[model samples]
Target: MLDARREDLGRMLRAWRMARDPAALPGPVPFRGHRTYLTQLDMALLLGVSERWYRALERGEDRGYAREMIDGVARILALPPRQATALYRGTGHQPPRRPAGGVRPDAALLDLLHQQRRVSWICDQAWDVLAVNAVGARHCPWLARADANVMTWAFSAEARYQLRDWEARWAGSLLGRLRLAWQRWPDNARLDEVVRGVRREPGVAELWERTADTRETSDDAARPMYFPLVAPDPVDVRVAAYGRFGDTALRWLVLTPEDPTVAFP
Candidate 1:
């Protein structure tokens, strides 16, 4: 793809990357100078590709790219509708049949969940629970269901019971992140529905306006929770977060115990 059109693509890619709002970017993006534009290396990490490969692709020196990889870039950069269409067309990859098919849960990602001895789960950018491992299911039974969502769950009575200081720590921060996700994916109907549902809760609509500094990965801090199986009392947990795998459509998270010796229930 080293032709003239390919050269145009390379330039377009560079421009799009520059114009992206780092605040709206879905994944962890390192700050760069004053712009805070996502660097090539950050793009590589989020796409689960080597920096060398991503550089080659950006330069249009790479050929026969996978549709999933380009789609991942589009998602991260929050490309405009026209530009996104052109990017796919330029890459020669067919568009997904349904909007919902755009970012389906990865089976391979789900398989990884089962392999984790600790509580682990896979979700999409919208925080929809696609799959949870046995340990995760046992620990948080609410997460095992098909329609489970992180945003909606945190507002539920179950979450209030399980989480200590549920409103101040968990729900407020999570709602802030959901707003950021919505900024990145305004066209995402599922995520929009999530925001809508979360707002309908008492006082949440007003609360949404105040949390402007949160992101999905902001849940990294140790959270106090009541895990009946783990202990009779509340315990502080460090929830480890990860991004996309080979499929580039999921987020894998594991809730690691603070005590290394603590066994999975």
Candidate 2:
């Protein structure tokens, strides 16, 4: 592992570059002396960026570097797990996660999810299921599936039978939130995978193309849904949106029954 002891991003990057064997990399050799390390210009050429742009980025003078560019640098430098995360943070970013739906909720988060008396579910930024409360599980047993995603299910044909009004109450609003997530974390591979999954279903691609529903949250509005085996009747719910420990990467949702006399069945 390369020494990331240096707090400076440029220094860390330089160290990583120097640690690499120039001959091992697939690139034209630099003409200069020692032949021990790849130069900044080499990094720039590999990244498809201008030398000035890469220099500014290395010097920490550039704060607006794109996620793809950072990812490219990480791949090119072959940064170790810890060092990769550090590089991302030093560049005012977060490291990309492995595969889609790989997020594991910690004990505290799992406890928080189980504590909710109301129908609730916890998901990662990609809307992949992390935890589903027992109450929620009974209401929609499909959530118990190993690879369940609320957004993906919402757009599926089976969801039409479960939701009250699949298009207006759920589709537009739900798709809006999905689109918003895509906009917020375009570099998230899992999130991109989720989007692709949704669009593959008939009519979803057309709906996604529409610009009318960009609202991130699904609160205030009625989210009418059905639990056929459990409730039989459609339940009007108010969707409460939240993030775990102020981290947007994890989303917590509580579906509160609207009527005071009514409770989740």
Candidate 3:
């Protein structure tokens, strides 16, 4: 039973991570592979501690890393504000509250979201890839053009190829975002289902046990992130866009490439 709950928490963590927007996080862009722009050693510096001790915290070996330390990590990871608070309070012990709504996209918003440059979509707080624009279809091969779960893309073999730095960068960022979405609108059944689906993957399952503290602060200068474009270049092409609430009932998201030279064509 403990193991089951651990897995459930892991899934919730995974879902939450996928829902975050890097622009909302803090810190400079990190070299790929470090968690939320900080290495275990960097975390030590942030905590005024040492790498070996920080490694223990990361390994889940420390029974008591100060609330401040956990919060520090969450901030570094750019966890959605609520998730960060909850994480600090819970000491990495809780999963997000279950989401309440189903995955539904507004028709007009869908049209607009697709019309944008790259690819974008809408999912209720559950992290499902409820919808995607043509650019998403064209660029993000790992994500299903039809009903999809961002978590699926995170865990898929294709995702590793597409994301390149899945463990440190994409996985943590995505999960942190997803958690924020859940915080904003928990009790969404569709989001829960998506969370469950992605938790089945091994790498995701492993990371979920640690904590939901993963941040990625993307500045205006930074770009949207995408993958599977012309290969040889490992970093997924950067894409950017924002979610605009058309009304209480609908949201519009536009995904566009950060680099104008790299046209969608």
Candidate 4:
């Protein structure tokens, strides 16, 4: 029941909007910061095209928009190139050839992850192990044996022992995100593969069969869980899950303590 043209424009606006950085935008920071303030004129100038032509393209009234123009607009908006291309394609426009540079972490990102003494790791939207810091590696031995998967860690016997309240604390949150993923990227092949793989993992398989619903919102705080380290007392860690789309293949995750400790203090 949705108008195709309107939907395309709306998606273009949303993708471009969310992709911008507040600090990078002009002005003294508007109500919602930089992303919201980037206007049609700005988009036009960024694409090196006329305002009229850009507006027509965005409005889905023009089919002659150049692929280079869309690429330029995506670059200026900091939109993930793939999603940006999808946006253009939705509007019946031809997108540029796909870039061959698949999700390679630069030296800077590698260094950042390697230097983190805290239990921190990075996973892409498709749940690929882009990088894991040393402390995170120590905290998660599975990171060594195989690739890192947040879901796999939650379901394993060792991890379940570490996180006692697995169902109450973890399942709902992860499932909620999975539902959101299903809605956002219905045709995502990688996501489908991950869902199938997780279902095959014992505990995760059981949860997949269960018909229960739990919602995860950005405002919700992570449920507190204690992990028994070799130390005399259990290390209390607050598990927080956050998502941002920069490199479509990169999502940063940080797990820190509710109270300060020597190493993380």
Per-candidate clashes, comma-separated: 0, 0, 32, 0
Select the stronger candidate by TM-score from 1 and 2: 2
lDDT of 4 at 5: 65
Clashes of 4: 0
- Candidate 4 global TM-score: 0.52
Off by over 4 Å in 2: 1-102, 216-219
lDDT of 1 by residue, 1-265 (tens): 3777877898889888887766554222334555657678878866678898888777877578876688677767766667777778788876543342245444565566678888887788778765677788788876654346787888777788898988777776677667877888777777887788888987787777666657555567778888888888777778777876454357788888776777776
The best-first sequence of candidates by TM-score reads: 2, 1, 4, 3
lDDT (Cα, tens digit) per residue for candidate 3, span 86-192 = 55544554433432123355556666665666556554444444555556556664333323456666677876765656675566666766566656655565566
TM-score of each: 0.58, 0.59, 0.50, 0.52
Stretches of candidate 1 off by over 4 Å are 1-102, 213-219, 245-248
- Model 4: per-residue lDDT, tens digit, 1-265? 4567655776667556555664442111213432544666656554456778766665656455565565455544545667666766766666544431235556666566667667766665556554566576565654432234565565566766666466776666776676566567766665675677666766676676573564445425545554445354555566555444444556667777656643542
Range of the 10 consecutive residues with the lowest summed lDDT in candidate 3? 22-31
Relative to the true structure, how large is the alpha-carbon lDDT of every model? Answer: 0.72, 0.72, 0.51, 0.57
Q: Whole-model lDDT for model 1 versus the true structure? A: 0.72
Poorest lDDT segment (10 consecutive residues) of candidate 4: 25-34
**Which stretches in model 4 have alpha-carbon errors above 4 Å?**
1-101, 203-214, 217-233, 241-246, 262-265
Question: Which model, 1 or 4, shows the larger TM-score?
Answer: 1
